[model samples]
Target: MDYQIARHNMVENQVRANKVTDPLVIAAMEEVPRELFLPESKKGVAYVDEDISIGNGRYAIEPMVIARMMQIAEIETTDVALVIGAGFGYSSALLSRVAETVVAIESDATMVEKAEKILQDNNYDNVIVVEGDVVAGYPKQSPYNVIMFDGAVAEVPEAILAQLAEGGRLLAVVREAHKVGVARLYEREHGVIGHRDLFDANVPYLPGFEPVESFVF
Candidate 1:
């Protein structure tokens, strides 16, 4: 496959026309080989504008959703970023360039292994892929400048919010009822005080992020 052409098409058709105009994000997408991150069986479909299934109950977010969330996060060159539900390390690779350091958290052991190999092969030194549950978040690298849920969540748990630094920001596609929208949440000294929905998207559901179930007597 002509990777360059596919990347260009992704920038033009999926990102630009869809309103993700940040130059840094576009450049990152161009730099990272999305196909390399996906499973060998699905490499050809990497940039096809649809979410690809990564093993262990996780799915990579679509190009449009990734681009849009990255653009909305307004990541700075010096910012520290955290990516939850990092399936094949696609989002982690894309974020490495925009943020100073990227901490990618994946729950599935096999997927983490695959992602780690891919990131190392690409020489992305700024990223660290670790296995962990999404609900707990990665506290070892707390106080992230930008926290991104790379998949859709039923609700943002307070545990994750506690990891964000003061004035840090988080972006995620929140699925409320049946509707879904990308939300940008800001953390302040007191707490995660404010957040606003940016746009609607069809993102994959994140495992273990739903509200706790109670016994119905």
Candidate 2:
């Protein structure tokens, strides 16, 4: 069996079950080659309805979770997007279909190199994969209309909030211990307003974003 049939089944059953009705996201999952982002051994697991292990204890976000975040972000063709933990650039490629330009950042050098190669090979010129610890957010390319964290995090840092353009939105799956929840946060005029609990699901945690420290007596 090929990934095409599996991917389609995934979109219809798993993704649609999670309320991912965006036609664009569904189409991307069907057309984009998910296996191309995996190692040979894990190629068979590409359409397995879960994260693809990419080494360093990291994994790409499940397709349905990505679709959930992207759908709530309400992507626009002209919006500039910042994708944290780009893995092998699959999300960046999909985001490029909606966002005008995509800044795909990964803290791992090997993943960065691999993402760049994959993107170049696929002719994804609108995306730039950077190697850096910009998990909080990439400042050099600040003021993005959309910021999507492919993995779950304990908190959304101000560094990432600062990167959002006025009225821009940041979408992430936040983990509080055993719980995992999705949020779509907007940078409002005075402050940020988040509409959390879009759904409850499991996603791998992003590195470098552990919970903030608290004072002790």
- Highest lDDT scorer: 1
Q: How large an RMSD does model 1 have?
A: 2.0
TM accuracy, model 2: 0.90
TM-score for each candidate, following the candidate numbering: 0.92, 0.90
lDDT of each: 0.83, 0.81
In terms of lDDT, model 2 sits at: 0.81
In candidate 2, what are the lDDT values of residues 71-112, reduced to their tens digit?
A: 888888899999988888888888987789999989989989
The TM-score leader among the candidates is 1
lDDT over C-alpha atoms for residue 172 of model 1: 83
